[model samples]
Target: MSLRTLTLSLLLTLLAFGPLSAAIGVPVTPATTESATATEAAALEAAREYTASLKSMTAKERRTLKREQRRAVKDALENHQDASTNTILLVILAVLLPPVAVLVYEGELNNKFWIALLLTLLFYLPGLIYALLVIFGNM
Candidate 1:
């Protein structure tokens, strides 16, 4: 494989598994070792296939591919950021107004919002708990 492919493969491998592996302090076993090897092999193979396809494409096609990839990555990042902000806002709203939080999280005045409103009206704690569960459950 070319240098670009190799670099991309290594970056992907790290991005895919590095954080989880570092965060989890589980001891390595035969099963874990086998799975790790399989994952690495799959990543390498995917990178090779991607690079091979790129090699066969014309310069214009490559430029278009790169542009599309960049746009996709940017959109994904923006979506993630929006989700984080929404979650934070929802958490605050859940504490202050459980029904409103549910409505915002659900993006509509539906059954969930009605349930939350009822719960909040009947008892504050239950409403808060339900709102938190609904917000965090989907995550």
Candidate 2:
């Protein structure tokens, strides 16, 4: 079975047992009884839907779906790695020159760059810290 199928199966198992377990040791008032009945009905409906979907799909379709999921995950990981590398480079530049790092990160000479320049002129550590915070916190 695929990971998704296994996960859903586990979920179904939990849902099936949840109401029974809740009723086992607790006193069921009318409100609690109604709540449990609703929970059970919802779980049954979900199981039916899941089983129906499974029956509807062919093996080929399932394979295609899994392939698409894998591709999406791979693309996301690649994008995350690229972002981390860029952040690291920016951090290094920020430590060396705060105003220039802000300008590069902002992709223009914006007000942020001016703020960094002003901070750097007054005190080096404050500007470096501000540039680092902008690069890290914004992400």
- Candidates' C-alpha lDDT: 0.82, 0.80
* Residue-by-residue lDDT tens digits, candidate 2, 68-134: 9899999988877578668767866886788999988999988889999999899777787789787
RMSD of each: 16.4, 18.8
C-alpha-based local distance difference test score of model 1: 0.82
The best candidate by TM-score is 1
The total of clashing pairs for model 2 equals 0
TM-score, cand. 2 vs. native: 0.47
- Compose the digit string of candidate 1's lDDT tens values, residues 1-139: 9754564465446545645757587766566788999999999999999999999999999999999999999998887757766777787778778899998889888999999899989977778789989999977
The number of clashing residue pairs in each candidate reads 0, 0
Best by lDDT: 1
Candidate 2's displacement at residue 52, Å, is: 19
